[model samples]
Target: METININLTNGYSIKSLCADDFNIVKELCEKCSDYYLLIEGVLPSKKDVDEIFIDLPPNKSYEDKYVLGIFKYDELAGIVDIVRDFPDAGEWMLGLMLIKIDERGNGLGRNVHRALSEWASNLGAKSFRIGVVIDNHKAMKFWSNLGYKKIKEVDMEFTAKKHTVNVMRLQLDE
Candidate 1:
């Protein structure tokens, strides 16, 4: 998959993440750890983050899963992961999405969202589903502005934090 790189106001280039970007990915994940803890109610240890890098699934490798990264210059800025629903489920899951705090407001999120949606559409996905924490008003508003509506809510338990989070889904098809 080809991704066009764009230079942000900070002179960082948003591009596709490659296999050799483990260090950058690790840094981004580390810097954004607190944000994830507050928003997702789970704090991932450095080992957990390292394991995530070790287990990154290849992009466009299967009909059901996709993983994409956003890079800033030579560093990793954000990531988005999608997985198709189980048979008869009729939806695709927007599994994971994260953007570094420094790169938050300069339209990188929208760009990543558009790129992922386009990829999903190309892969025959009719809709995209995501879960957001109810307390994350900023994220809730962001997703809503991107045409995602809350379809349902469920309680999820995070073992690392032992906190119950509210999960919300957004349907991509309009």
Candidate 2:
């Protein structure tokens, strides 16, 4: 699939994520999850990072997987992915949506969400789902602003700590 660039007011753009972005994605994930209850406490070793990276499917390879990067003047600022999975419903899940700390507060999250939603719609997704850690109020608020409503909760274990995460969903065709 071709990556469509989203022009920003500051002259940067949002582009589709590629395999070449693995290193940046790894770094961004590590740093962004510093305060995440699940990752911060569970992933206490470098091996954890490696394991997580290894588990990710190749970028844009799966028929229902799409990853995107937020860029500022050619610098990677953040990333987001949509994976269509079916456990009960044909759902598209948002994964690893992150913005570099310094590059945040410029409405990048909204832009990324818009881009991902468009991509999901093109994929014929019926609903969009995302899991947010209970402690991550900022993310909860952001997802809420994008019209996601809390639908379920799960007790997730990472490292040795337990976290209650809210699974939020948005009906796409509504």
Candidate 3:
């Protein structure tokens, strides 16, 4: 599906990211080393960058996935990966949403999510879900502040490391 550009209050804009954006994505991922090191216990890899474009849940098509880049003028400031109709119809799954380390703590993440949520809701989304690593306190707090409530905990392996994740859900009441 074609994704539209989302403009933010702070002059940041979000657009669809594709294979052509691999280099920028890699750079952004590298800059956010703290997240990678904390979650996987290692630096980001080429495979990790590649997965942003091709990863999909069972029975989901690539067309259902969206890899979006958040930009500030000409620079990439963050990235968001979302999958439509995952796990169930009308529910979207946010696989990843990382703001450049330098851009954190300024309410940009919240704006990015609000824009994406509006975009998803227009496309028939009834709710949104995300998985936060149990040990990632910052992320847990971020999601909680956005009104996402814990649905359950699940053990999953990512990039050769095992983590217990708190699966959270936010119902989009329209």
Candidate 4:
């Protein structure tokens, strides 16, 4: 992956995270127990943290994935697992985006999304894709508010539980 600048306002910095930051990412997940509970019905495990860096869709490689950490003053505050050209060419897939529990409702998520959007646009992305668990209404609203429209809903198994996912997309400008 080439160097990409993510301009986050409010003293936040975004950078690609690596294995050395596993504990930091795990700690962030621990802080986001509510989200995991809502989606997986359990707190994050070591395997879950590992999946953050290893999991990939069919035909996608590690080279196509970017595990980005959102930080403030050197403290990891959030994470985003994004894949370039996933599902199709000219598209980007947002596998996950999580903000620390205390960081919610402060507009940090929106700022991160905006920065990522601009970055994607600069990369010549034609659109962006994301899948939100149907039960995660707050996330659904967030994506919808950002101009993502529902492309479809599919039943899928996640963490050994059946889930309905709302696959949404935002078409970028030419």
Candidate achieving the largest lDDT: 3
Which 10 consecutive positions of candidate 4 have the poorest summed lDDT? 1-10
After superposition, candidate 4 runs with Cα above 4 Å error: 3-5
* lDDT of each residue in 1-174, candidate 2, tens digit only: 556666765766777766666777677766666544344574324564344333443443355556667788877787766667633346777766778788777787787677667766776778888888878878888889889999999998766677899999988877
What's the TM-score of each model vs. the native? 0.72, 0.78, 0.97, 0.95
Expressed as tens digits, the lDDT of each residue in 1-174 for candidate 3 is 786688887679999989999999999999999999989889999999999889899999988999999999979999999999988999999999998888999999998989888888989999999999999999999999999999999998876589999999999874
Candidate 3 — worst ten consecutive residues by lDDT sum?
Answer: 1-10
The candidate scoring highest on TM-score is 3
State the local distance difference test value for candidate 4.
0.89
Candidate 1 lDDT, tens digit per residue, 1-174? Answer: 454454545544445555576666677777888766775456656565554434433442344554457766666778766556532255677666888888898787887777666655665677777777766677778888888877667766554443334344555566
Query: Cα RMSDs of all predictions?
Result: 4.4, 3.6, 1.0, 1.3
> What does candidate 3 score on TM?
0.97
Ranking 1 against 3 by lDDT, winner: 3
Error of 4 at 60 (Å): 1.1
Alpha carbon lDDT at 66, candidate 3? 93
Q: How would you encode candidate 4's per-residue C-alpha lDDT over 115-174 as one tens digit per residue?
A: 888887887788999999989989988999989999999998867577899999999873
